[model samples]
Target: MKMFGLRLLLTVFLLVLLELLVINIAGILPFIASHKANISDAPYMEFITDNLQHPIESSTHMIEEKNPLFFLGSGAVVLFTIYATFFMKGGKGKYELADKYGVHGSSRFAQRHEIFKQGETVGVPAKQLMKDLEASMLVSKGEK
Candidate 1:
């Protein structure tokens, strides 16, 4: 849970950073456009004047030629972040641990007719889990 919280925080932080980068760059769009087009290039404006151009411009006259690949790439990144942060589940579906283990079971009640499954096992304690593992390994080796 702590790890998940930390990951979510980091994800949010990255999202904010990306948004700030876009907005800050957008904020100085006019200046960037002015400078790149050999206009009155302002001083102390390197913060927004990356060589990488954004299509969303500040002004019309000083249009800085934009790289569509960069825009598309960043847009995709932002879109993915939003989806992963808000829409995606904690670990189910596309990010399911059960999928990794090839487990066909779903912990959800819907797997049953409406609420309950026919052959669901009760939750096992940790000690029982260890014992089960040992028993399963022995059986697999034809010793049990």
Candidate 2:
């Protein structure tokens, strides 16, 4: 469980770093947009720049919409996180041992029926059949 938590944290950190790297490479860094209005321009150029003051905002929106790689990476991370949380159980299944031994659900019922059949064939009570089976199992294990 501790290992799982660590893996989940590492996955989130790597995904965040990937997002930041993608945003930087796309030249849509949020700091640049937030600070664009603080940049100084020549007084004579200010008149022409007034119409362009919101260009960074518009371009950032466009980049966000058009950047397919960013969306793909984000989606992959979300899917992987969900899979890790819900499906991946560190190589163990919910019924791993039960399934391996055919000891769950219909299989368990089938095993009981098989034991009943064996008891009937041998003309013995269920308790005697069970004891005989147990003794045989112990002998087999000792032989192994």
Give the alpha-carbon lDDT of every model.
Answer: 0.59, 0.58
Clashing pairs in 2: none
Runs off by more than 4 Å, candidate 1 = 33-40, 44-78, 86-144
Candidate 2, which segments miss by more than 4 Å at Cα? 1-8, 18-65, 92-144
Query: lDDT per residue, candidate 1, 1-144, as tens digits?
Result: 998798789788887667546555444655556578655646635545542254244222123446443455468768978787777777566545543433455553333343344566466799999999999999999996
lDDT tens readout by residue for model 2, 59-93: 36546667565456557767766676567667867
Q: Which one wins on TM-score?
A: 1
